[model samples]
Target: MTVASLEYNGKPVVAEELTPEAFKKFGYVISPKDQAPKIPEGTYGMAYRLSDASIPVNNYGNSEFKTEAPCAFNLQRFKPPKALDRENKVYNLPNVERHPYTTQTFFPMGVDAEKAAYLVVVCENDENKLPDLSTLRVFVARGNQSVTYGAAVWHGGTCSLIDQLDMTMFMYDNGVKADEVHLVETSGLRIEYHL
Candidate 1:
């Protein structure tokens, strides 16, 4: 058995609308729509949402991420699996990971709002500090959105749908051990969806 379980109960997990209210536990939804009605003016009127994101790292528990870790920016390319691109409807959740010391953000680039999409699969930690399967939740994030995985939260991989997607990700890192913790589960994670 893996560190978690899923509800493949025949009907898929319907990647419904994502809301910051419901998603606060895992992280936050960072889209223009989620921004306050009035964009706060800064030193320059052009600056946008500069102070909106959660602090890059949590400085609690004597965490080194604050003083020793450098905020790393990376570009990621993701595509649907060969077996389940635009033709198929089901996706398997093969793995999950957590960045214990820092919050991670993903911003899709040049994606068409109508055609590109991805799933956000996340869950809370169990009493034993592992991913709690019963709490798993999946949200559909489209081209206009960005997601931030809170520090120490467990979440799935890219899981994009339809066409290929490119993303810019930001996170704090030490380049070893504190980078990420992963769980690779081979079965029992069939996610059904329709493009």
Candidate 2:
């Protein structure tokens, strides 16, 4: 949906009408409500030790943070996947690990509209088949929604333009930990966002 607003000096000034189709053009998609994305039953990914031991001194008081070693953490950035390319082009956002509740803010690069449009969700310990998309609730993030995605929840990404988009993602997890080996079933659901 289109939310209208005026932008002059790089600040939100108004709200406008928005539709799922219009938003999808720039890679904004509605989170599927009908069937939850199928998360096959399995164990959490492997855990790796934080190489930087001294980092704890500075990070002690911090609730969450992006690891300094971007490469080490499988950190990734991408243009939101498009139509036929959906399944084959999936890109995993780095570092999903178990954690306690905490708040993290992320500002995506160059999304200019009255408000931002995207889908986000949180789920845990579910092995049911994914439901239909038409039956689901697609959450559109207008401004910063301090929503907490539970540990091991499957979620989607922010919408971005054709150009490179950088997101300062934050996580409120227990400590600096990275999970390895995300489990993907041999066969999976087909998700398509109307563009």
Candidate 3:
């Protein structure tokens, strides 16, 4: 589809409330509901566990998924953009990135307990292995929520709604080019959101 023919003045996409059902296509939503104590006693902590059996993980062969030597553990701090006035408006999106061989998880931290939210954008790959702009989706995430993106899922950078945010990022890398891939929109496309 031509970029001009798309909605949102050719660049705007209305972000929706993040939900487990709506985000299943991209990856798993690690929310309180999903992590409810599975045991009858409900005494053990952290009822959910992540493994290759349940989701895609890159360093299965390694005894421990270590990031200090090869992979990277990043503590990213996202600051709210100055242009953001309304919660429903997503002003601009320059590019998107994805980890093809690894699953990435974003764990929120150091956010205000009362009011903390962020934006998540994802897109599927087309036949050409490029981001299918038509499949793009936007989600608003709260502070208590963490998202684990499946391998090869196109996603944008962290965007905070409050003044500041801290998110712990986990990913695997072997000093190779295949670790991450970034894609830019050539048609000057920008997505805006409407209420």
Report the candidate with higher TM-score, 1 versus 3: 1
> What are the runs in model 3 whose C-alpha is more than 4 Å off?
1-11, 33-56, 59-72, 81-88, 112-116, 186-195
Strongest candidate by lDDT: 1
RMSD of 3: 6.1
Query: Candidate 2 on 99-182: residue-level lDDT in tens?
Result: 232222344434443343343422233344221222222233433322333333333344432344455454433334433113
- Model 2: lDDT of residue 70: 22
Tens-digit lDDT string for candidate 1 (93-152): 766777777788998899876444788888888797777666667777878788999987
Best by TM-score: 1
Give the higher-TM-score candidate: 1 or 2.
Answer: 1
Q: Which residue ranges in model 2 land beyond 4 Å of their true spot? A: 1-76, 82-105, 114-124, 127-148, 156-162, 173-186
| Cα lDDT of model 3 by residue, 45-158, tens digit | 766654532254675244243343255679898787654554655546656677666788888896543344787889888786777777889888877778888877888767
Candidate 1 Cα outliers beyond 4 Å, as residue runs: 1-12, 36-50, 58-67, 82-85, 184-186
